[model samples]
Target: MRLRRDHLIDLRPLTTSPAFARMWVGSTLAGLGGQLTIVAIMLHMYDLTASTFAVAMIAVAGLVPMIVAGLYGGMLADAFDRRRVALVAASITFASTAVLMILTWSGGETVAWLYAIAVVNSAANSVVMAARQAIVPRLIPRELLPAASALGGITMGIMVSVGPAAAGLLVAFTGYGWTYTIDLVLMSALFLGLWSLPSIRPEGAVVRPGLRSLADGWRFIRGAKNTRLQFILDIVAMTFGQPTALFPAIGAVLLGGGAITTGLLTAAIAVGAFFSSLFSGPIARYPLHGRGIERAIIAYGISIALFGAVLLAATFGLLAPDRIGEDSANIGLIALAAVALAGSGAADNVSSIYRNTMVQAAVPDAIRGRLQGLFIVVVAGGPRLGALYAGTLATVTALWFPPLLGGFVIVGLVALLVRLAPAFRAYDAARPTP
Candidate 1:
């Protein structure tokens, strides 16, 4: 019984903080809706363009706006009430999604409209995410930060897993209109969560959102070696390791089963995250968060490399069907690839738990929003860069080559970066320092 208890996720944060619980529930539901829209958009673009590069460009298009919003949103979070900032951002997201739904229903959604709306959605979401993340440390106790982060993993797991799969099925059967409509309905939950929260102004010297504020945040980060190192490590891992941009093509040509395959491949990562968070009790007890982050990311790189190997095997006619297309699939290879992706997801979640806890515990409240904003940029921007990298490389080379080569690049780069930053590897959770 004790062993079982030790291995289970802690529930105290939810039971102890009703406000956090309400917010978590709202975020989870709203996140599921967000995923629906994201996957739907990808599928919509692919159907219209039939170009993998075009599909990848969706994320790329939003990169600049998302970065700007994240940084400025962080400053807003610091200067204004976090709850209000989040609410305003959520409102923007809701309105944009409504526009998407209306356009799809009216048969007026061109590729250009889709791209523009996606940029708006992504930009607004960055602000919402920056504010929401900054709010977590204030709501929960310091000791429960890891558990809270694990719970966040669970939210992500459900959102990505169920949302993608559902979006695919909806787009396949009900068409894009229904998918967008469902997302529109789910976005309402975010308002509930944000509206229920009390006003949470920054606890320290607040910095207004602008050039001077960004400079101050940058100065703080420059002095905070451990925090800075974690950002670099995350960038390295994400830049080389992300292969999501290739999923659409992989499903169509390499793996088969079409939209279903894409959805399954994407959802597999969340499946791993969900289970990892479900059994995260032991993870919270580990003191060396720095070491944990390093080891987990290394494992993530290995898993991604293995996924590449699975794709490579498919190319060699290993466990492959004679004719692969939307109607048929290489189940064996798909399963292997899903397992590899799931492993990567689990490892990434573990790294996130440590990184989030470190940041929340180490950074002061006054600067926490700005720092988290920067973190959001790295978090969101890294994947955008990864999409461009994978998409361009795959366009020139082969589908399997990007993850295969990029995985090793991540492994080597992360190792070198960590070795040089002794302070990051030596970070102790008990005595948190930025």
Candidate 2:
């Protein structure tokens, strides 16, 4: 296929709005730092407790609080200036990272302290994320939303690809204190992004940030069939398809390269996301967003199933038994697993592009913050649930079983949901309607 320049990631958003560009750069850097802290916390928890379950608990602990913060933060974005709301959220994250660094540097780090700080950080970051997403639509035209989302994907791709790799190395060479310190330093970029933006209060009738306001957002969502379906579809995709928490175990028991394998597996997904965004010209041109999301999620489910198949193959003695240990690596199985993960990553990014575009285009500006808050909750919460699902299932059955079964579940459930939502299947980007 002959690729045209327009098929690539459109850079119009960057040139059109300097504020958006600065925010994009700042958000990207800050996000990279956030990833560092996330990976570091997991490694730190594992070191402190020496248990994978304990590490998993870190995410589980933060899930509820994060949901709360996302909802409240979205309200705040709608009520006050979005710039201020984002700055406040970013400050909270900065302070949390600083505290984390201090604890590590002063030799006062403990499992409880780690858990407490991590939960706080997660809650704060969710707010920042919601505010940021809400702000993007304000900065660019509706037609350019897909491009902006693709840019977001590139930012996420870089963060995930580099941050974890950096975390592993920094932890190995410098120590946890230095690693945390680096994140604290990198977070300064976020201030620049938020500072450059103008005050952006939500248009239309503003409401107080309370249950009533939240209920109003819910009312809108309830009435908006296509929007509701997109949310449900995303949850289905994330809940059943996400298998991130199993990477360490997969690397140690199944793929046999320990941290290196885990890093590779994680980065492979990010690489796919990055490449997909880099060549997102084709993605941005597509107008049938509903069908696009449907097809993309199905592909995502298939890729996850393929990854499960690879793991199952390893269990069936496709790889040498002796090579199935941290000390002895199975290069071939690791390669296959990475390929499958990459495929999943690519498909998931495509779904996200369409889903985000639909939300930004269809929803009213007045309630966009609240809806975005709920969107953040679904996006953040679904993966945590998936992590729990994968970990529990793997512990109960075998490492290969969770993704294998979960993948099929995603495929089946998503198909059914899309079938039931006929309007979603007919959604057109040219005439976006909630």
Candidate 3:
């Protein structure tokens, strides 16, 4: 097959808009810190309780507050200046991180303190993310939105790939206090991005931030079949296929690289996403976005199953497990698992590019904040739900069973949903319909 020339990332958004570049850089740095904290928190929980279910409860603890914050934050973004909204939300996150750092340093950090702080941090971040996502369209043109989304993937890619690995190393070598303190320091970078942005409010008929505004947003979702389908499909994919909560256990028990293994497994997905976004020119040019999303998600499910298979092999002693606190590496199985995760990451990033493009292109700015809020809730909250699923199911069964079975469930469900929603399957990027 002849290689396509337009497979490279487009840098126009970065070069054409200095403001976007600044925000992107600042967001990227802050996101990196955020990922560091996420991984660190998971590791910390596992250390404290030595139970996967306990670690999974971190997501459970934060889920409801995150959803509420996402909804209200979207309303705030629509009603107020998005930049200022983001700044305020970011300040909350920064303060929470600072408190976490202080607690860790004091050597008095308990599981309760961690969970409480994480819950607050998750809620605050929902607001920051809603405002940040809503502000993007105003910064760049509609046509460039896909490219911008690809750039956003790159941000996630770098953040997830580097941040987790760094957190693992930091926590493993320097201890938890230093790791949190580093995140606290890194969070300060977010201010640079928000500070440089000009005021951006909703451009059309404005709705006041309240229950009425939220109901209107929900009404829009009910009417927007394509947008709603994408959300549903994403939730299904994440709910079934995400195996993040299993990583710490996998690293410690099955895979055997301990913190390094956990970090590597988590980072593998980001590596795939980063590379896919790095070479997203073909994705940007694709017109039939719905089909693209469906195909990518199927591929994602397949990769997830493959990962489960690798884990199953390890369970069967087909691969060697590393000893605890030792440098013993299960090179073959780790490589296989990483390869599978990398495939899933690339597919998910492609799906996200199309889904994000659709929302930004088709959705009206009047209620874009709320829709994006819902989008954030789906995107961020789905994984938390997945954590609950994977954690609970794995606790009851085995790590490999959940993903192995869940992968097929994702493929079957997504195919069924597409069959039910012809409009969604027929969606075209060039002519967005929401």
Looking at model 1, report the run of 10 residues with the lowest lDDT sum: 204-213
Clashing pairs in 2: 7-281, 8-281
Each prediction's whole-model lDDT (CA): 0.91, 0.86, 0.91
The lDDT of model 3 is: 0.91
Best by TM-score: 1
> Which pairs clash inside model 1?
none
Between candidates 1 and 2, which one is better according to TM-score?
1
- State, as a TM-score between 0 and 1, how close model 1 is to the true structure: 0.99
TM-score, one value per model = 0.99, 0.96, 0.98
Best-to-worst order by TM-score is 1, 3, 2
TM-score of 3: 0.98
**Cα error, candidate 1, residue 290 (Å):** 0.9
